[model samples]
Target: MPSSSGQCTCLRPFLLGSLLMLGFLLLLFTYINPNMDSPSLGMYFRPAPSCSHWANQDNSTLESDNETHHTTVLIWKWPFQYKFDSDCGVFGVQKCYLTDDRSIYNKADGVFFHHLDIHLGDLPKIPRPCFQKWVWTNMESPDNVPRKPWLDDLFNLTCNYRLDANIPVPYGYLVPRNSEDPDFQLPTKDQLVCWIVSNWNRNLLRVQYYNRLKDHLQISSYGKAFGKPLSEEDNKKVVSSCKFYLAFENSVHKDYITEKLFRPMSLGSVPVVLGPPRDSYLRHIPGDSFIHVNDFASPKELADRLHHLSKNPEEYMRYFRWTKESKMTISWFGKEHACRTCGYIQKHRKSIEVLDSTASSQPPHGLLTASSRPPHGLLTASSRPPHGLLTASSRPPHGLLTASSRPPHGALKS
Candidate 1:
């Protein structure tokens, strides 16, 4: 109502002041609001709980336990020894010392030949019948051989361990032609038959005839006598290509589940197992994962099953699905930590009362006992120390001590 210029000036200052007040209010609201996102805020100033602190604490505890409970185990070196070795911290028996001399077996040969003896004599605590090797035919005579007593003693000492060493495959090896091809190359049906005819032995024929099978079914062998050894990678590829594999055991013994069964099953191939009763082998593997020769009344019956399975891809694929869905991870050899011998030792360490009378009932003469207070704090939780800390105890807490305490990894020596 006064001058137009005066009114315009009044509105300008008012608008400016209002905008400034609105910005100031917004800043104040942001500072007070707990839910507001502020990128500039320091982590320490934040009100939220620190998950990093908890994680660090957990990791620290694990490290501490690992530092405390380290153990070193001495093992006999052998090429065929598939038992766990503590030094490698891996599963499977590794060949440490190889030798050409047959007269005096090195640690490996000694362990291989006298496995039962050493185990029985309490010199070695490994499980019985540790490998899948053919016993020299000359040594098969049960006559006045010293090995008989050793076997008998081992049997008497530990009925808990299984001693069967069946060869699932009779000098069988796989070789893959090409892997990347959608239609991977496999041995032709005719080629397989021809190979079998050339390589079949009297023993092998006996197995075929005893099983009452067809002569027309395609079968082949990569013979050991011929020395056509398939490389490890080729073996894996062959398994992947094949729908079925023959898992022939070297010997027929009770409760022996060999790699012939394990490898094929692991590679998503259905195994045609030729060892032990179906029930015995199932103890080690998932039921329905394999087809046993004994399951079929005749060779035709077995062949029919195989043919039907091959034609029906859905059913055949089910076997592999079961393996995957179950998340089963099978190892051809036992883990370093899985030595039945070491397992026994760990179990008895706390329960051992006296060294003399408390010796393991099976093999290896050491007796362990559980004490309210173990010597050298071996049995106590304090035996474990922080990681990188020297002078830590070998005994680590196996379980979480409390909400405030946790054990470290690599803490135990096993």
Candidate 2:
């Protein structure tokens, strides 16, 4: 009813007020929830190894699991007699139970049998139930895993590091979120290149590369090979303080990356890798986070690249940009395996499956093995966390010690 000029004048304050409110909301959202980029699930992380089919049929007792049933996965033998807590909830999965007591094996829905613990003569006494499934659990690489033809029909499922397994467990993973800053303060560096290794086999490709690398640069070496025995504390201090860590694997194969890579990565030291090709690592981590030894034409060229990056802060920080942006997730070893197995059984409970008897029993992929025997004077894990037992088969012997994990007497914790 008013004139055009008068109407426009009155609407000015309302438009200004709306614009101010909208700006405030956008700023609030941007600050509170930073990463608007697409999730890094398939890129950085391997989809968290979820139960592909989903949960189980209805069980009225538990209100949890969305009216679905709970499942019990029994470990036939504790790996290396290194026991872990049976709580599946600790790994963020629900309505799942894990147990090692052989007495209750009859009631369990599924069972896990470790490869190393299975002695041929000593086998399960009881007859297998029609519904009960025996899962073959092995984390050994292709070569080290001894062929067991007898196991062809025994295992209905597998638990290993392979992406295609019923329960896939990689050494570490990256969360799908991004932070404004990773809160990673660089440790004081007293060394340039650090190689903490016990296994010193010249025949191994990694050791051969290390010898060539040392010819080009001065590497501050530690561990049994160098006669400088590092305590658990010093092991970490060395990695954190060094500008770069040589995460050379004792053996090379697909998906054989181990704690040799993870320890330095978690410790804020860039890893000069010699294990799998760069493409294999790119699946688990960002492309620029590590320097693959193969990328360089020669060891001298690789050493030159290291020197150039060391002197240049901008170039070197690219290797650590992921730590500054995303949260890192370490494999809580046995906990993840048990939880995933529990989830897998619940999903496939209605669908009875029998593995083809002709299939090879050797695990396709797993924690890598060193080429030869473990180095001398091996210091076993003095302390062990309840997550899982660390075995030589699952890691490069004394791969690298972690702050919390207590690998078994012969196993290295990372």
Candidate 3:
């Protein structure tokens, strides 16, 4: 119906108009959605990056100045694995990703290793840079672990994951209604002294001490290390029923307090603690709360004190006084543990520099023993937030007290 020139002229404006509209829309998207890299709007159409992908991306973009923004920690060894979902953020640190592949060790800001599982054959050959922190963690003290001269100088931070560690990963429980409220009535406990030991002869000193203590008084025993197997519930019930529980350590080392102390304290039992100096325990526990074995010259004398307390319920109840304000539960494991490790790194990676000092050299501050508690403190709490009882509510979400949680990485592992 029209000439060829007229037809071409009519189509040119429509094509040009369509292209202009498309160009304008692309420009708008590029401005609003910074993630859209391609000229095609695939970012708008495609799904968001999965956690692993995001972690990979994070590793690629870890600017030296922006250490606070990244959140990936590598578990360098087995026995402990990062168990949380990729999206769960704890204490403000996001879980960008976690991997067992040690090849990507540099990608992570922190590297975690269970001291028990750490071996010379399995160690990473690469020296970790200052930005990368190595966490020296273990449930046992130095005495418990086999001699590894190389391990003495391998960590940027220490986690005494057991109850009395620098990070004090003590167990937690719901505070009792009566304990917290002065008006609520206190419950009466029935049983006498009990010991739930699973290792019979592991610690010769502990074995010798327990044998001597049992000679003076009737000590009910349970667990594989002693009497028999008990379920978690039954064990708790047993401990709760007892008036006193032997919260004895396998080996006596400075601040090597373990669940033995925490379990009894949480279950309303007066813990007859037999590790560390009384003053060291004083740092974590209320002085009046438990009886220290060191307080008495011998196991028999300790037995006599327990005997007197059992007859005197009013006196026995004094041990529960501290429970009103503080509740003791169990240490976290799996993902929760990983979250804590990650959060600790995000907060401290910038400040803490890993030093491979020999045992003879001066060890890091904060990680010093009870001998240093009176005067010398960890590096200096100047860089950290104020510390509190190891409750989620008490600890500052951003940073942890260096003095409280940085016990010497190289210590007896009882």
Candidate 4:
């Protein structure tokens, strides 16, 4: 055995040597090792690039692509939610609108369906089976009542419409012209003036409501209040010359389809619609197809977007890409339908037949039980089908409702 002092001295050297070796190992692992599993021991680390760099790159790519491609548009007049016949329109015209039965045969321009449903809604529940489907929000009879209760049933039966698909029409309405000729002479600014023709007081009410827009843009207003109906020549000139037009509806309503949205696009003028959220309109129309009052954060913000478009003719003309391909028009309830959503319905004849078969095959007890239960969460808020029309009191929050629940239609008596 060693002396106490000697033993202590020996232990001190051993302990100190072990600690030094451990420290060396830690340092080596931390600074030099690339494959170290320990986070603190990793050899390389760096911060992410700034948002501005990513944004700039994205914007540059968008600008370059836009310059190279031509944009095409299909017009539809039916409500955005209705799915009807598919075989009646252009090859791709399944997505375009039709003015009349005759327009389906004329596809010299590109296809023009009423709306495009880019977002695919719930597959199992939507009445029409398609890879994609638009909503036909505009379909209304002469009395302005929706012609079909099936539409109401669809809204009541599915949360699928909202969750699976974005609204189909860009704006609730669109303007299209008869002539597809690109060289067609548009009206001059001096020849064209603001025009409104409606029996409803709401038309003038909106005029007064949005007077500031007229003043800022220096546009002139004329109609029954100002004078006679603008002549065809004058109307053509007015549309051709003016950069923008006011496409106010007689009444404010959700998913109300009107000619106001259509006439502006027809004449190559930007229509500024005064109802619903801009997103609601975009659900049906192409991106940047029309201007919505809701798009502006404020009235002043709306003025700014208008001013930008006014100054930039190229930007304003960009909207014409959808219209110029074909002078598509909206067709109502004929054998041939113009709306893409409607076409999708027509295309899936087999699936609809299957649904009918399944319903028929179900035992009477099961059918009765299913009918007694309320529509699934998907069908809430939407108008009741003919079989089960839920009253306004029964309408569910965030659920689908019939176009009848939509504004002007809602006001109409059932």
Candidate 5:
């Protein structure tokens, strides 16, 4: 037999070889299958796809040709589909394509829907795994859409850009003073006051107010609910002829002002707005530009004021001064809205979820009063918000994986 020293030397080589093999496996395991349970490793193991790099290489481009390079936005609603090329980019470079093809819904960069049209309960689950989902609602009021707890968690963005005055409407809608046009002249007076109402019975408050106003003075009414519907041009001409137009909303809500207020304001007629509180209007429009129904003690008083304005051309024309100095733009809610959707998706590239209570904590200008919250049963378990559930912030919530680390919120319904 070999000496004890030789045996010890041979054994050392074998033991050393075994130790090296074992160390190699441990290193390979650490690299190939990381400990996902570790908080630090969790992020590294399952990294989120960067939103900016998701489509830019293929679908998205900085090119002016929208046809060649544009982010596709699927419209779930057929009637309210926003398809016109408003070219809403930093410098007229088209970047959004709003479509309605189910085939593209999953692949679409975003999905768009209106509050009045969609009901989430019926859908059961989101139709497609879109990168973003947008809801457009200008109709939610204390009496209409209820505030749901999940709204902040559901939608990725709010298509209701109307509430912000900084976002200008379509270019064609802004009717600036045409001093150069020989045909242009001061709007001639026609009816004392006009209301292009379609909801005659659904809203008892509106119908009751209309009746009370009529008791004092005559107010012409048009639309299927009252009379024959006027054409767009005819409606504009009629509103322009009138001294005042009732821009009452179906229901009152903060920042719920709609085209009812804007159309009359654009046409040089004083708008008697009745949707949001007067303060909300002041934020977006001149305080003197509109007459708030709440400001009047009674319908008779409102009618009297309207009558007085109709008689005094100088007093009535004062409402037009804001328009004279700075032209008012009306959003072609359809096309301009689509442009905004595109512009938003193109710029923002991050995963996020907004918290409702925080997001809707304040209105565009102020806090939500107790009256703004819906009464019990306004939001049922099965109740589907017409505009979907949540509105999103442009930035990603810090530590997006953790619910508690969510970013601050924004508004919905309004």
Candidate 6:
């Protein structure tokens, strides 16, 4: 009995010590992270994957006879399924494959997502590779797209119209064109001022501005609002005949300028603009290119200026002078966005690394391709960046992302 008691006494200290050590560890863990309810708390602070952290690897380089490395970008959702050419040929991006095959997710070097299609319920389900990158894009204004909390840290890049985006995709921009070419000529004008609106939103500032501007100016109206919807062909014919077109936009946002300004100028009509400030327009077009409503104290003043310009043929002709120096370039939205996605992935291959987003965030996912967005003008838009955009920063960024507004935001509809 004494021998058994001695053995039991020795075991008590050992067992008690083990229990105390475990209890101490439990207390330390509880102190380290007090809130056990929210697992996302940990994920919220998880460092986004950095380019330097990812060692250079062979990655998804497709081999060819010339040895050019091909980067595969899988589009997870086609924004309205507006696919164009199968590749990035339009953007002159060579060596990049834009595909919609989910089966190839494991092999793709990058995956692109349009904000409109991203439902928290339907995210990528496959295990993320260390080398793959995920891109988030939204081409809509904030007025249209409500912020999704999931947006943080989940994407490696952004593509959009905002200048700060990783890949800046403007609606359209001014570029040098041959004005001396005999084929180009300003159309003969007969009308005073014109406006064509299809999507009418009373809440828009352009609508309110138009209401007041019309009281002072003799303006011709077209499209659904005036119950005279012109076919696209007829619409251009009317705009070309008018001396001025009200290229008013639906929203006043930074870099939200769109085809409202570009189409009128293309049709040889001065665009009486109504979006962004005059300075924002000046960034893309020459100072004398378009008439901004914001420059005048009242609609009456803008009306008086227009009347004066109409009477002064020499002054009116100056508005078309940009034709002699630069041309407008607006791309079809879907294909160009995808092409650029592929090009960006290919170009920044060194920085390509998949985000280690929370495993619980995964949802059943698929792949895709799509398009939309454009550019602007003047007699010659002054020295704006060729595409009214700055490419990805020169720094070796963590990952490249771009944004573009979608349905909630109008490309030009006001």
Q: What is the TM-score of each candidate against the true structure?
A: 0.44, 0.71, 0.65, 0.40, 0.59, 0.70
Q: Please give the ranking of all candidate structures by lDDT, highest first, separated by commas.
A: 2, 6, 3, 5, 4, 1
lDDT of all predictions: 0.36, 0.64, 0.57, 0.39, 0.53, 0.64
* TM-score: the better of candidates 1 and 5: 5
Best by lDDT: 2
TM-score of 3: 0.65
lDDT of 3 by residue, 279-334 (tens): 86776678898898888888889989999988897887787777566555444443
Off by over 4 Å in 2: 1-69, 176-182, 356-404, 410-414
On TM-score, who's better, 5 or 6? 6
Which residue segments of model 1 deviate by more than 4 Å? 1-72, 76-201, 204-206, 209-214, 225-228, 327-340, 350-414
Q: What lDDT does candidate 6 reach at residue 254? A: 72
Model 4: how far residue 133 lies from native, Å: 20
Candidate 2 at 61: error in angstroms?
Answer: 13
| Residue lDDT tens for model 6, 1-414 | 569889998999999999999999999997876434235322211222333354433344322211343566788877765444555554666666677778666556677887767887777765555556677776666566555645444655567765645566666666555444344487988899999888788888888888998898788999988899886578879999999999887766776677778767766899999887888888778988898988899999999999999999999999988878666655457666666766666555445322222111122211111111111100111121122253323211221111232322333344
lDDT of each residue in 23-55, candidate 1, tens digit only: 999999877764432354221111222334422
| Candidate 6, lDDT over the whole model | 0.64
Model 4 per-residue lDDT tens digits across residues 104-154: 222111222221221224212312211122223222212333233222222
* lDDT (Cα, 0-100) at 98 in candidate 4: 33
Q: Candidate 4 or 5, higher lDDT?
A: 5
lDDT digits (tens) for residues 248-278 of candidate 5: 7776655666667776765668888776678
When 5 and 6 are scored with lDDT, the better candidate is 6
Candidate 5: list runs displaced more than 4 Å: 1-69, 77-93, 101-107, 116-152, 161-184, 355-414
